[model samples]
Every structure is written in structure tokens, then in C-alpha cells.
Target: MNQELDSAAGSLPHDNFRCGTVALAGRPNVGKSTLLNALIGFRLSITSPRPQTTRHRILGINTSEAGQIMYVDTPGLHRGAKRAMNRSLNRAARSAISDVDLVVQVIEAGRWTDEDEALYAALVEQSSPRLLVINKVDLNKDKTVMLPFVAELVAKHSYDEIHYVSALKGQGLQELEQAILQRLPVRPPVFGEDEVTDRSERFLAAEMVREQLMLRLDQELPYATTVEIEQFNDRPDGIAEIHAIIWVERAGQKAIVIGNGGAQLKAIGTGARRHMERMFERKVFLKLWVKVREGWVDDENMLKKFGYTD
Candidate 1:
């Protein structure tokens, strides 16, 4: 893995290669991040059972013999974004969709909510070719029932192509990839084949800790918390040492995160460190601390400081 990361052997060998950006657009909890990881064959983005798990625009690159596809996984766009952080997420999602080679609107296999309709309306305004991906098809046991749902959708809206995929099970991905490649223009690959993402290891460190928070914290507590990396250093002995702070909105939340005898914090750190070691391919020693910020979610300046703004 280290050797592949250090080499740049995958380049465009032919002039007919197709390379461009594709934004995975959708509402919350619709499997957009899952689709991205499956397509790129790398777990660049974090995932949980929570809505709005992705808060920023993440770039995952896939380079093959044929072409390189840059996949932008954006935060799920939704309505009634009243909080400053929620609005910031919406801003990131909207900004990501505006400048892309293609837009893939992902939705659940058998259901389309108002948020999906709203996103479709937004995508209709874009000049880029749009594709509708009905994800989580594995959950839909009866395939015949999807005919009418798709029939109604097509009658009311338009898409350049429609595809059904199960991102978790890796179904129907080849055809989707072919369709996406065919629509992209012929150009040289922008990134090397071995490169999986454009994000830094520091940025990914914070995300890995936050993924554990989302999975372990109860309702509403996870949304109120954000992880900040204080230090990430590679030691002389070749081990990575990291110190992180878990910022919450109130003292009560902080206590809950710390738990009785620091059990909760220990669990969170252990989970995050394991994932970091796996992804970074190194030994990771992680330390965590809980802190209160007193409504940082509503403070715009604090949001900017936390790297929420572009």
C-alpha cells in the first residue's frame, strides 16, 4: 500500500480517455456516501446510521485503465436548515453540485420524499448531465413493484439515465460506471490511479473520531458534538501519536460523553484509533478529551474556525 501511494504509474495511455467530476447529490441518509465508497473501491468517506453524516464535500478518485473518475461526495441537501451548521452543510452541498461534470441524484429504492423532489428540482437547473441512482435495491425484495414508481418519476421529471444499485452489496455498479464514463468528455486523468482521495491525513483523523461519536452517542447529542484534532505527529519510532478534543454544546453533554469513570471516552478513542490504524496503515496512539463550547453550533464565527466554511 505504501509503495502504491508513492508511485504515480497510472496515467492516461490513450487520447480517448474519459475523465471528469461527478457529484453524488441527495438528501440525508440516502446512501450517497456508501455509493461513493463502493464506486471508488476505498472507504474515504465515513458512514453511520445517522442523517447528515457527511458535513463537507469529500473528493474520492478512481483511476482505471480506461479513465479516471473524480467522485465528489457532498453533504445531503435538505429543507428547514435552521442551525448554522446545518446551513453550512447545505451551502457546501449546493456549492459542490454547481460545478461538476455530472450530477448523480441518489434516492432510496422504493421511496421518494419531499427532500428528494426538492433536490431533483435543483438538479434540473444545472446544465450537467443528470443521472438518477435508485440505491439500496437489495432491500426491495419485489423488483416488479419498482416499474410503476419509476414510471411515475419519469413522467414528472427528466434524467439522462437511470440506474438501480445496491451500494452495500455492490450490485449493478459496472453498468452505472460505464454509463457515467460514456457521458464524460475525453480528457487526461487529473490524479494518479493509486490516489484514493484528496483529503489530508489530519482531516481524515478528525472525521474518523467523529464517526465514532455519531455511532455511539444518542439522539441529538451526536449532532451537537464535533471533533477537533489538536496534534498529529509521527514519532521517531514510527508510531503516530494523536490528541483530539470532543467539543460539545454544553457541560451536560460533555459529562455524558465522558460517562462514568471515563468509560465512554475510552470506548470512543479505542474505536477511532482502530479505524485510523487500518486506514493509515500505521500504529496510532490516540487521546481524547471532552470540552464544552456553549452553543458553538449557532455561532457562525466558531463554525468558520472549525473549518465549516470554504
Candidate 2:
């Protein structure tokens, strides 16, 4: 086995091919997931209007002749350390940014919050090359202010480049891709040419369920919820069976998710199944059950069991 691996490694040739990991780091709701989906041409990371929607480091691979840019979409780094769950998310975000080829610091157009400033300040101290990106540019009414805003950003720390893009509208992504490709080191592609993400379908299924909860619930309930896939079976036929448990921190939360007579759970399940069917291009039977895991977020064992820790 050692001889065979050595032979394959010796024959490798990537003199000028560009390939490396790019970490998308930013504050909450800065559109990191949207930008990642736009660049990869697929929906790997779940997105919602809610802040801190992402809780893991999702890897999206963009393969092209220009080069392969493996983008790591991380959860937004925030100061919410009220619970062990929030600290787990923050640790995931920090770990994703380290040891990457480049860092894409996403920020909203014409807006800079305290969290953004704190994240940017930390990025400046890192050795990796960082690119300041102004996302949601199309939402800004005054286009002329972008230049000044970007200039002001440059004065803080010399970014490799500044990109203005609307991730939802698919504007200026080409330029961002070009900049990423230029900054990447010469190496062979890390993922297949046609591969979009490194995450499995089961993980995506769980995220989709959580997305549904975020979309349907209000206030702090969504944050108290997490999904666990208990059973996943691929039939010989063309259908997939999935059974998931929605973990809530309280019994009241479980009632909220279950609704008066399982109506809310059925609605969430229906939406999730439809979305999975469309994404997978096959039949998906999704089943969701709400359970009270009381104070799971603060328990390290429970957090690790649910795949929330690094």
C-alpha cells in the first residue's frame, strides 16, 4: 500500500494549476451562505433571514479551468456566548478561518456593525491574505457610496482586493471568482470537477429541517431547536426515507413545534420533503418528531452527539 501511494504521489503533475481553500468569514446575516451558493451554483448551505443560521463549516467546491476554489462557508462569528451552543458555533467559525488559502471577509453594503468591526480586526492580525467583500450591493440605493465605503475599509487594513457583489442577484460573482482564482496557490483540484460539496445528503437533510423551523418559528424558539436524523434508508426503488427528531430545549417549545394537533409539524415536514425532493431529484419521505431535550445546548455531551461541536 505504501509503494502504491508513493508511485501515485510521484507521478502527480500540477506545475501551474491553481487550487486552495477560501474561508468566508463575517458577522451574522452578512450573506455568507448566499455568496457561497452563488459561487458554487448550488444550495449546499441553508440560508434564512435570521441571523446565525449556519452552525457548521460547509465546504463548497467550485471547479473550473481557471482553477478550483474550495470555499468554506462558516457560521457567522458572534459575541453571543450566553450558551455552550453559541460558543460551539463561534469555535466552528474561528476554526474554519484558520489555515485557509484566503479569507473572504463579507460585510453588508454601506453598513458596519460592532461585530463586523471585531471580526475584521481579528482578521487583520492573521497571516492569510484577506479580501474584503461588500455583499447586498443591489440593496443599497446609493451606488456611489460604495467606493468611499471600500476606501474607508482599506484604510483600516490593506485587503488583497475589494469585491462588490449581490449574492442573491448573481451580480459581480465572476469578478470575485477571478480574484479568488488569482490568489489561490498552484495545486491540483482537491475535489472532483463535477462535485459541488463535501457534505452528505443526510447532513443536508437535517439542515433543511432546521431551515424550515427557522422560517416557520418566531423569536427565540428557532435557536432552541435542532434536528437529528435517526433513520435514513435508500430503497431499491426510487424513493428515500428519512426520520428526524426535532430537539427543543423545553416542553413548551415542543408543543409550539407540534402545534395544537401536529399541524405545525406536518406543515414543516411537508415543506422539507418537497424541498428535498426537488434538490435530490427523487422521492423523499420525511418524518419529523418534536422531542424535549431540555438544556441540550448547554450540555457538551448532547452538543457533540448532535454534531454541533468542532
Candidate 3:
């Protein structure tokens, strides 16, 4: 596609300093998480094929000689706000674009839908500089169509720049990083150089369990399912202990998560623990329990209790 990081750093020294926030905004499943992970060179956000797999404003802090690129990886900005939870997610995504140095609007290559248009309209209302990112270019077979498609996108928004990338395979990411770095404000870094994310250990652990449920359950997934980290401890013997509760919106969904003879829960726990061990780099003991909390996604108080916005 348009593979160029020539301007991402722009004649700057290897130790040039730049640091600020860049909000990655797009529709659900548009590789926003994949792009964030690729840019940061680590897994700060969890990913699955499921829509709304990410519900929070995940930050991935990349501090280098070029300075800190503090990215705010937000959930997809969508129009369907039928549920309180859905509205909350939209709110979080919308809030990310405000008071930010740059906004990178990620869209799938060679296609534009109404949802994409809606998000574009929202960004146009904001004053922050925006870059148009056409992701998943690897999936587009006909390379010739990319030019015309990019031309059409150029007419759609007043973008400062346009980049094409394959977030999954790390194509054109160097260019993406350079483009972002050039736009970041010249200020002191906001986070520690060693820190990858602002989320705590408990928050990331809960997300790991939730990611497992989405991957394993498939169609049996609950609309309002979440993981609560009841206990997280690191023993002196080099074992990490974690107890997480899977909260579902319905009793039947809870049963489905647990599966027949508790086999499903066990399988899900196994998958989650493997990921946990890899993230923590230690032997992990993960305990999971399922509970049904009907209509909790719609209740403001319950939403707050689960670390969700009302």
C-alpha cells in the first residue's frame, strides 16, 4: 500500500524526544487492538474475533529515544446504543478523541460502511489533527484497487496523512509509528519507561479470563459477561495465584459457561492460565467461578461495581 515511515520521525535524531496521547478510533473488530499491540511491540490489550472484546480505554506506553508514544486504545465507536453497556462503550471511545494530540482513525481497506461514516463524522467535529489509517491491506488481493480506494478516502476527510498497514502481520507499522511520532507534542513523557500500560495487574488478569471465555464459548457467549479478579497474589516460591469470577447476565448463560460436568469451565480456565503464565512469566494458579447477575449491564450501580462506566 503506502509503505513509508520516512516522515514518522522526520530528520530527527535517534534520541529526539516526543510524547503525547494518540487515540485509535474505529468500528468494532477493525484491528484497533491489533494495531495498538503492534505499535507498542507488546500485548497490552487482549484481542479476539468477537465484537466489543475490549471495553475499556487501554493504554500502551512506548518510551524510546524518540520519546514516549502514549496510546489510548479505545473500544469501537458505534451507533447501536440500545443497552446501557453499549452506550457506555461509545462514551469511552468518544471521550478518547478529546484533549488528545492526535487521532488515528483506522478503517478496513477497500470498504466503507455507514458505521465508518458515523465515526468519521464524529472526528470531523473535533479539532485535533486526524490521520486516516487503512488497515488489513494484506487481505485485499487486488493491489491496483488500493489507489482508487485511497483516493476516495482522501475526499472523505481532511486528514493530515494516510497510512496503510496490516496490524496482524506488522506490515507498514514502522511508517505508522513514524507518522504518529511526528504529530506527538514535544513534552516530557507521561509514564515510566519500563511501564507498558496504565492498567493494574488485577485488571489485566480479569481481561485474560474474559478473553478466554470469548474464544472458547463461541456462540454461547453472553452479552454481559465479565471477569472479576477476586484474588491475585504472588508467592515467594515463584507461583502466581489468581482467583477470578465469571459474572453472567443469565443463569442459563452461567450454565453454558460452566458446561456439562464443568468441562467447559475447566477448559476455559486452562486456556486462560496458559496466557496468564506467559504474561507474568511464572507458574500461574488460576481459579474461576461463574455467577449469574441478571440485568446487571443495564444497572448503573452494578456497572460501576464492575469497573464499567454508566
TM-score winner between 2 and 3, please give it. Answer: 2
Candidate 3 minimal-lDDT segment of 10 residues? 1-10
Candidate 3, position 118, lDDT: 91
Lowest summed lDDT over 10 consecutive residues: which window, candidate 2? 4-13
Q: Write the per-residue lDDT of candidate 2 for residues 155-261, one digit (tens) a residue.
A: 87678888889999999999999998888899876666667887889999999999999999999999999999999899889799999999999998999999978
lDDT of 1 at 300: 95
What ordering of candidates by lDDT runs from best to worst? 1, 2, 3
lDDT of 1 by residue, 208-300 (tens): 999999999999999999988899999999899999999999999999999999999999999999999999999999989899999899999
TM, every model: 0.96, 0.94, 0.92
Tell me which of candidates 1 and 3 scores higher on TM-score.
Answer: 1
Residue 169 shift from truth in candidate 1, angstroms: 0.2
Give the per-residue lDDT digits (tens) of candidate 3, residues 185-235: 776666655678878888988888888888888674645688889999998
Q: Largest TM-score belongs to which candidate? A: 1
Of candidates 3 and 1, the better by lDDT: 1
